[model samples]
Target: MPMSFYAQSTVQGTVTDAGTGQPIPGVNIIVQGTSNGSTTDFDGNYSITNVNNGDTLVFSYVGFVPQEIPFTGQGRINIVLQEDAAELEQVVVIGYGTTRKKDLTGSVALITAEDFNTGNNVTPENLVNGRVAGVTINTQGGPAGNSEIRIRGGASLNASNDPLIVVDGLPLNDPRDLSNGSRSILSTINPNDIESFSVLKDASAAAIYGNRGANGVIIITTKRGKKKLQVSLDSNTTVETLTDKVDVFSANEFRSFVQANFPDRVDLLGNANTDWQDEIYQDAFSANHNLSVSGSLLGDILPARVSIGRSDLEGLRKTSKFERTTSSVSLNPRLFNNHLKIDVNANLNFEKNRFAPGVEGAAIVFDPTQPVLDPASPYEGYFEYLNGSGFALNNVPRNPVAQLLQTRQIANVRRYFGNVKFDYQLHFFPDLRAVLNLGVDNSTTKRFEERSTQSATGFNASQGDF
Candidate 1:
């Protein structure tokens, strides 16, 4: 029994994309000229046990160039794969179908994930900023505000100029806010899950959409699984501050101007000088997180993505704050030898906003020489004007600071968007296919406002829901 002994070892390794440094899953790994084979997991990790030291392993994946390595008694071996340029040709998604880049006859622009804008972009429109020609993106309002995208300028004088948005084969209605026009629907979408964007600018390119395409058309396609399995996570945080402010007369400058211009009314100057603008402005913050997983099983591909985001913004004016929470999920599955495909996308968004009182407007017109608070007046401890007799002054807008602190307006909005699509190609004829799609968009909003009873406008409270 003093005989010979054979030693066995275990081999483990990871596969990654050389270009993007991302993991590649579902890759096939086999021992050369042997039946021993294994597949990588979602994390791009694979292991083979009971292997000899001199065994040669082969790594192969679709759309990528394969590589071979010898297991020189090492426990771990990592490999990088290069993409096959020939297999990476451009693919365009049109109104009702898809076409290769060389087959397109109309003027169209394609934007892939690699071309998206970097940073904390809350809306999909922001992702395309300064990336496309003849297209403009304008952000309205403050930090958590929505963006307005214009393609080739205005298309109509009396009608809406917004382009039609189509997501994963389903057309979305205009995301306009009829009441007060303060909100936009595109703000609910998660930009991290977008795979590509197709813009139809010319009349010939948008003719397929008919009347809705007059303004333009944008088709959004989300990510899906390939021949490999992959898992990825992304997160970031941001801090925001006022970039520039309007130049206003300082306390001493205003006093000097008033004394020189209105010598007779010099007594109108208050004892204290305050900068109303500085009293209201504050800082804001935001954070975002995203996770995605995709792989293949039993000759079928499954891809899923989820994202969670939150933003808290403080406006330059006091009591002006906006908070929003967004979440979304996308799932895609392929079955029946690639003949059956199903895609489901769902999103949920919630927003809360507290608008400043007349303070923001009054800060510009209110007397800068006036004191922020009065001690002996009837409205003690509150910013106000009073006469020598200890009575409240009249015929003037309420103190900007008092208006900001005493009045309250709160708005809450909840929105949900979901869609499901199915496609089946006939086994007899691969060219012919049948499709079914269903979708829904729903939103609810509630607003509450209240004014103090001691204010000049008296007590007032109102609530609305839609």
Candidate 2:
């Protein structure tokens, strides 16, 4: 055996983002086989003393890939780290505890932030749309509208197909009905705030959640503060248009066919022309913005993160829209020689929505020759076929656009979800650990729906606030 002695020297370096080239503060740098270590500051600079040429330097950060570089008498070494997709997905968060995927068995699926769908994924369910193998995301209408998420399909017809949603150890309700304009309970959560998703598909994998896991279990872990202080902004705008307009006759096309086929019946048609499908649909725009700040608090003793996000989603239907504001805070701290870990996370969400019921089917069958509006006609200036008793005719269809606009359903919802967990490893047995978790989920829903007296669906008017 040959033994060699290497002189110890101080090493200094900067850590930067691989893609953005931005300075990354709070990265941990440690020399292998030694306690000698240091953390980068706000400028992404770190100086570690007593590093030998034979020693290996390890650089690690949350979200970014870890790196190990062997010291070869270099005084300074700058490093760039790419975002690590496996940082969140490779480690599993479940009822028992965090376990690596390679060590876990049963029908389990993982999806990290990197695996999320691109474009305007405003809702939580939309993030996993086509990514998971057995999970099916069924969206109704358009963005911000109701959605159905089924894990390996439904187990029973009587119960809901929604999987049990556990966010940071807090269980929450999912979309169930049309009461809320945006029926989804998870609508308040910002998709950008999500770190990863673990789906327990099989009975054995979901057994930890008990009966609630019968449908399946979806574990959602939100992002926590990184080792370094970091600021990030995510903004995106999406435009949606009717790709192929029903493939039906337009106002002009219907008029020509009506005249060529039945000249005598043309007398019953009105002079004004309208395309029902075109009138009901519109070029929609959706916008999402998220800003987050994360770093160490109290001299690195506590890692804290704060995030704010807003989403404005416009449905293809002219009358439907959803707006939401979301804010969250997370703190994780280690104590007692890294044996005790405490985690606290909280989220607040507010939403305002105008739900659009299914009226697209009616748009196709409605007459294209009729006008959308008439001054003399009732129903809020929308043309309505009335019977002798001054009621909207049962046989004749109402304007699809009017059906959406005249009957208004507005919902304002607010939700707060929070959780705190404490885990302590036994000093006697390093592998043994004791854990305690507490969580709360609270929500308030307010709705106002009205059908004007003159509208086709309205024989009486109904309204409320608060």
Candidate 3:
């Protein structure tokens, strides 16, 4: 029988930092070109079995340069790892330019999509909340609302304290454009398309924009296509309810308290004891869906992405609802050996807002003894107060339930934003490049407010457009 020469050997070694000379724990030791691997123990000692003379061993650790060594019949081998300066000097996007983190002169925070919060994020700001230090994201108008981002607090007294948003080399709309209350252009952007966020916190990094960057600057880079075709679909739904309800008196408690305090006026109380807070508030629901496809084409890479999203939200108050629909398309193509690149992006958003009247004030002040519906009154089905006459009583505020049903405030907004950018690198000087960008942002808003003749306010219907 022929003698078998194949044999396996165990290799043991310790890994240490070159500069500190301290043992580095959790170092990964892998047999090159094979699935076998091991990790260093607390003493930085790693042992791997089944090692051959020609086999290669790979040692790797975070923040340390990886090293590969051939077994070469050695049973014990010790290795020192040098710190990876390149990993520490990652690239950072600044205003009008990109710089290495080691070369940066000002405070800047970089956040990528991978680091974004996981959940049903409806807006870009929602993805950034609580992730970056010194960045405060204040949700302005409840669920699916716009956010106010302040880096290191407000710097301006009268001017807009919100950061200047630059998306894909184009300046976004004015942050102070809150014409629709708490809705802003940032809410229109699809968070899935975002690749990274770079926040310039100090003047040294944001001074390039002059006055516009006084409060700071947020740079948003959208995702680009990869070398291969890829498709992704994401969908989620969210249910929301008021977390902290006002600690007001319950129906029975309010009735007994009113009877005890105002004994003479006890007759003023209605036959029914109602909970106005419960009647006005409700559980709100919202959902979102996104689909994207990206790929390269021919010699040149052409990536096109289209996304559609919708959100329907019901406020704590009845009849107070906000619905928004957003659709966006981005096309990017590289030509001339990637020297010339063109990008075209278009976004359209439509919103419908129905606001409940007097819910904020009347819902809290309306008499709890009054029933939700007054059957005998002319407004028989609605909750209202009336004397012998059919008209609404003037002494007290309009019934909260009647106010929500009889009065209506509806706002419909249609907004469009489009931009085309061309970047061409000079053939003569490969390092030099020129860019031309043109963008348009337009919005139309129409508002309709009507107070029914039965409403206590008795205001005529009004319509306005902007």
TM agreement with the true structure for every prediction = 0.72, 0.76, 0.77
Q: Candidate 2's residue-wise lDDT over 255-374, tens digit each?
A: 788899988888767777777878888889988999999999887789999999998888888878889999999999989888999999999899998877678788897777788887
The CA lDDT of each predicted structure is 0.75, 0.83, 0.78
Expressed as tens digits, the lDDT of each residue in 1-466 for candidate 3 is 3222365689998999999999999999999999999999999999999887789999999768999999887989899999899755877889866778768779988888778998877778888899888999988655556677889998778877888888877787763665564366676677878888999999989998888888899998877766677888888777778776666776677778878897888787777778777887778877777777777666347777767777776766778777778777788998888889898888888877776664657777777778887766555467666555455566667777777778888888888877899989998998898988898877788887887665555622132111
Better of 1 and 3 by TM-score: 3
Q: Which stretches of candidate 3 lie over 4 Å from their true place?
A: 1-89, 175-177, 180-182, 387-390, 459-466
* Tens-digit lDDT string for candidate 1 (111-157): 88888998878778888889988888898766456667789999788
List where candidate 1 sits over 4 angstroms from the true fold: 1-88, 178-182, 225-231, 291-301, 357-360, 376-380, 386-395, 457-466
Number of the predicted model whose lDDT against the real structure is largest? 2
Ordered by TM-score, highest first, the candidates read 3, 2, 1
Give the TM-score comparing model 3 with the true structure, all chains together: 0.77
C-alpha lDDT of residue 334 in model 1: 79
Pairs of residues clashing in candidate 3: none
